[model samples]
Target: MRVPGSPRWAYGTFAWLVFFVVSHVVAVFFPGEDPTGDGPWDLRAYVIFNLVLILMSAVGAAVVVATVRPWGRRVPRWVLLTPLWLGSALLVVRGVPGMVENLLMATGIRRGGFVGAQDISTAELWAGLGINTYFFLGAVLLAMTTVSYVRRSRRDAHG
Candidate 1:
């Protein structure tokens, strides 16, 4: 059980995955609008994408926990850990910057043309890109993670 990094790293990664999925779901489906009254969401796309993301995150967390447990020794090491961690890492890559930008915007340190504003600044544009990039990357990672998880499971069971 002596991994290079703390178990806390794995736990924190798991938490972040969960938080990101839940936050995005809320944002997409239940966002309380800004003063301008238009919502920051697209329910149709949100439901589709979030359904995939939530499933991926759940599976990833299960794999991480199982891999670290004694009973999971029967499972191949890579099967239960690599894809899980990698998917979670990819999410981190996508999410951290967006989170930073949103935090800045929330504090008013970074203004943007959200809520139907006409002119958005360069920094705001970057922030919007960051947010979009996060979601796209998240979906890609989810698909990859699912494939890897299934492949590894099959390999471990048969080999």
Candidate 2:
């Protein structure tokens, strides 16, 4: 059962989880092919990125589950959810831009400057967009839900 006012942490966590899962699925099944001379896709780099995503996703899930634990019951709501909320927000900022860049590169829509030439594929671009959108939605929803939880906690604490 949710606390009298649990805020929206659960919702936020759920949203992010969806994003993480989708992105992971896409990355794993259909790794984007970058044609841009800027850089080639490296298995090691992808592994590293996946690792980070997995870590964050796990943390988010843990935090959400913790809400049902005794500690979650004892701690102030805002105090409980703040870290997760902040982390989710950070992920949004970091992931969203990377996704956008990847999408652009994949679509061959990236503008050329002093560094002319791009290595991208239309298929990769579509994949990037889907991945990026997933990340963006997940991050934003997570942030919002976390903030809601924090707010509810604060309110309950004072009242």
lDDT of 1: 0.58
TM-score of each: 0.48, 0.59
Per-residue CA lDDT of model 1 for 1-159, tens digit only, reads 222322434454455567776776676567454422354756565567767877777777676555435576587766765776577567666656656655655556655523434367777667686765665555444544445445545555689
- Candidate that would win on TM-score: 2
Give the C-alpha lDDT of model 2. Answer: 0.62
lDDT of each: 0.58, 0.62
Measured over all alpha carbons after superposition, the RMSD of each candidate to the real structure, in angstroms, is 8.5, 6.3
Q: In terms of lDDT, which candidate is strongest?
A: 2
Model 1 ranges off by over 4 Å: 1-3, 25-42, 92-159
* Candidate 2, 9-37: lDDT as tens digits: 57556656756766675776566675222
Tell me the number of clashing residue pairs for each predicted model: 0, 6
Indicate the residue-level lDDT of 101 in model 2.
Answer: 67
